[model samples]
Target: MSDSRSGLFGFVLNGLGHMFRGGLLYWAWLALLLVLIVLGGWHYYLQLRDGLLVTNMSNQVSWGFYISNFTFLVGVAAAAVMLVVPAYIFNRKDIKDVVLMGDTMAIGAVAMAILFVVVDLGRPDRFWHLIPFIGRFNFPESMLAWDVIVLNGYLLLNFGISFYIVYNHYQGKEPNASRYFPWVLLAIFWAISIHTVTAFLYSANSARPYWHNALLAPRFIASAFASGPALMAIGLQIIRRVSDYPIRQSVIDHLALVAAIALQVTLFFVLAELFTDFYNEGEHAASARYLFFGLDGHTALTPWIWTAVLLLAVALLILMIHPLRTHPVYMNIAFVLTVVGVWIEKGMGLVIPAFVPTPIGEIYEYAPSATEIMVSLGIWAIGLLLFTLLAKAALPVQCSFLREKAHREVTHDDA
Candidate 1:
């Protein structure tokens, strides 16, 4: 036990030192993250002091901005698997080169996702309520329980894989493929399960007709593909620009194509939903009408939904044109557009509608208050900062691993 404790202490100290070690850019990034985290902590403190009353949430619309962001971040976390499929399964060189980035991205994304869930819980101090032995756990009964379990499981799996491989490379040692690849394959399946389970959480609510569709899971997955790839594209481009690590154009091209196709599929799902709602025009369409148009003078969410749709259309156009997808400037612009579009569509756009025009005919519009916004911004800061640090540490290890692999190959040939 003493030896284990010593090793654990040394490991943590080494990690902290590595994460904080860098020049001006690093410090500047760290400073920005610190400021945001402080703001979020202050906001969360206010929430704890006053209770959930500080937020604009009510019985009519219980879900708010925090849950919306959580939903979107889950998709981002799952998107890391796109890299794994091609790199591990198909043996793509470009993807193999930057797979570590995706794993680190997953770690950051899952961390933020969990934070958002906790922030939305309102009484986070009582978090032990979800504990199994000591507290009540719903398990198969509560989809929320499934979500909590899957999210944490996925987080641990990715973090473990990333830590082992990256640490080995950092120490100038090669990672054992047999030890990690099986876990990598399992992670891909778990990634999909996370989002699908989240979708089921919404879909199971029979009162929320808007979320009751069979296509809801598919919609979540497709939109996730679009937004997740967009994020990966942007991050990889940044890494390519800043570091000596090589990110090939082929990887960018493949990501863009995958995002483009998924965006088109997402558009189809939206169109199908729109038709079903408009064609029948029953009580079930109330939320859809509220979202697209105004339902009984409740036009609060109309602008947001329309803006998201417009952004989706613009992004689709950029991807449809071969020239635009190939152009670095246009491709990057499309990536940003798709990410924002999906966040609005799959996140707020989906969550808010389910609650509007409540089951008993309530029309209380929910908007996130200033405190909520600050808390969210702070959570975002935490996530981005985590990603920045992970990427920063990951790059050197990845580059060295690549160099060492190449050296071994050359030596083998000479011998």
Candidate 2:
């Protein structure tokens, strides 16, 4: 018990140290994030003060960037399961070292996804209306309610499993967390379900032919895997450089393999969409037209969409080439570009399609208002800040364990 308390104290102090010592870049990022949050808050205040008329979103483009971000993040959160299944279940020793990092990132991603939903709400104060017992369950009938349950359940699963692993490490015990293996499996299925439900949320609204296809769910999964792993690869690279943590080259090589496969799958889905849309020559094709060329007189989004596609192609090419994927500098560049490309593709691509050929057969384009952009930035900042602090606290222990293992090996060699 005394040792447990000491460990807890040490954890708290270590976290505080990271908070202070996270350096100028960390603080600068935090400041930028805070500024965005403040600006978003002020914009939201004006929104509340003036009403929904503050921005361009109407009955046609009701969802906009917030909803798009929400959907994309669901995929991001689900990507963690890819890492977990291989490391914990298959006993992939290379990934074993970084599985905990994957879990920690899942927690942050899910939290941010939920935050985007909250910000997008017309009446965010009424968010508690979904609470069980206290609020209505409306199960089976309400997709939103289902989303709440699955998302919260998945969040708890991640938090529970992650805390268990970290706590055991703190006590210098081999985690008996294997008992929760079934729960981890359950979480994996739940991860898929969360993203599927998100896709369904858009698809079920049959009026929006752009999102109405059966392919949305599978495409979402593919995109999630590609973007999520790309982000993770970049994250691992950063940790390796900044701290004493020793992520093996083999681990990076394997991750690149995963990224490569996911990128291929995502590209296939994109091509499939093109084939379906052009072949059909239907209203659905209109959305693709808006994305590729322009719709009516609006071409604002076309250039940006093509730019993202170009970057994605470049990133995918780098990942496919063995020399580029193995090189630290090139791999990191590819990962960063891939993540940015996906964000643009998912954020604008998903939302704008729904607005084209509006309900009355009109087209309206959305550019996020200053306030909306700030709010989004704020949320992103919060995710980074949270991950930074958590990484600071958790990484030291993992690094220490790896160092001890290296020392043991060296001692054995000497003997």
Which candidate comes out best when scored by lDDT? 1
Candidate 1 TM-score, C-alpha based = 0.95
Per-candidate Cα lDDT values, in order, are 0.89, 0.80
Per-residue lDDT of candidate 2, residues 50-127 (tens digit): 776766677777877777777778888899987888987898988888888888888888888898888777887787
- Give one digit per residue, the lDDT tens place, for model 1 in 119-235: 988678899999877889998899999998999999899989988887776666778999999999999999999999999999999998999989999999999999998999999
TM-scores, all models, native as reference: 0.95, 0.92
lDDT, candidate 2, at 93: 80
For model 2, the stretches where C-alpha displacement exceeds 4 angstroms are: 1-4, 7-18, 21-29, 405-415
lDDT of 2: 0.80
Runs of candidate 1 exceeding 4 Å displacement:
1-15
Q: What C-alpha RMSD separates each model from the true structure?
A: 2.8, 2.4
